[model samples]
Target: MIGNDVIDLALARKESNWKRKGYLDKIFTADEQAMIVRAENPTLMVWSLWSRKEAVYKIHNRTAHFRGFIPLKIACQADGKVLCGGQFYFTDTIVTAESIATVAVLEERQLSQICYLQDREEVVKKEGFPYRKTNSKPVSISHHGRFEQIVTLTD
Candidate 1:
């Protein structure tokens, strides 16, 4: 499976003009751009969408060749979600048929908001919960979802 990891340029490195625009078009769909217009700085908004798209690509296992994927018709949504790449759609409709997303914010610490839209739930950060162990080891050391979720992760 393919995986992609995106970081906020503001939190990592400065982005060049070409990198910003190129990635903006490469990642977000038209409707998504409009929905995120509150940000006066095109850079930050694009950056947020970038993170979400990257996460979706990872979940969809299309990160190996993101360019093969297209927005809207193939793998992007207006409300900040993504489908799988078109190239593999016929063989694997599940990828592009559903939506997936992840978001990262630069708060005091690096906070990542992971969303698996197909599951109709988001991966959120959780704390202060009873610890469950599996195989005599910590099951996981991450957060859980607030909304009803069918899938979970432990790492």
Candidate 2:
């Protein structure tokens, strides 16, 4: 399965104060927090890790049919893998001046393609996954602020 997330840096800067007391403790593991503290750009590091966690959460949600918002529980390691509920997920992060994007897939799934979409509805029409057919290859789409990204897993 594939999952993805995007964060708009401009909007995030205007809206979030990740440095506030206890904010890091609420969402990041101790190791992650240390990485942030050591980062050259803490804001970008925070959002990059956040995007990765959110992406992994999406895949966990679909596969386990569960839902929750425990960001700290999703441990994102420095090596670009996420650990949650005894499962390990592979993840990738992309950081641009304008945004941060992350993609996650099950450890066993091979990613076939990655693309950007201006309109997600086009996927339904183009891929013929009207109800988002689960039997079909898993694809994840995420949009934030001005950007939209997708990750697809192949057979």
Clashing pairs in 1: 84-95, 84-96, 126-143
lDDT of 2 by residue, 36-126 (tens): 9999999899999999999999889888877888898899999998998889998878898899999887763443344444444545533
RMSD values for the candidates in order, in angstroms, are: 13.2, 3.4
Question: Please, what are the lDDT tens digits per residue for candidate 1 over residues 1-155?
Answer: 22233343433344345245565555556666674565675555554455455444443432243343544433434443355554331111111112222332212122232222233123233242112332121111112222221222222
Worst 10 residues of 1 by lDDT: 89-98
The C-alpha stretches of model 2 lying farther than 4 A from their native spots are 108-118, 125-135
TM-score of each: 0.39, 0.86
Minimum summed lDDT over a 10-residue window in model 2 is located at: 125-134
In order, the Cα lDDT scores of the candidates are 0.35, 0.80
| Candidate 1 Cα deviation (angstroms), residue 83 | 3.4
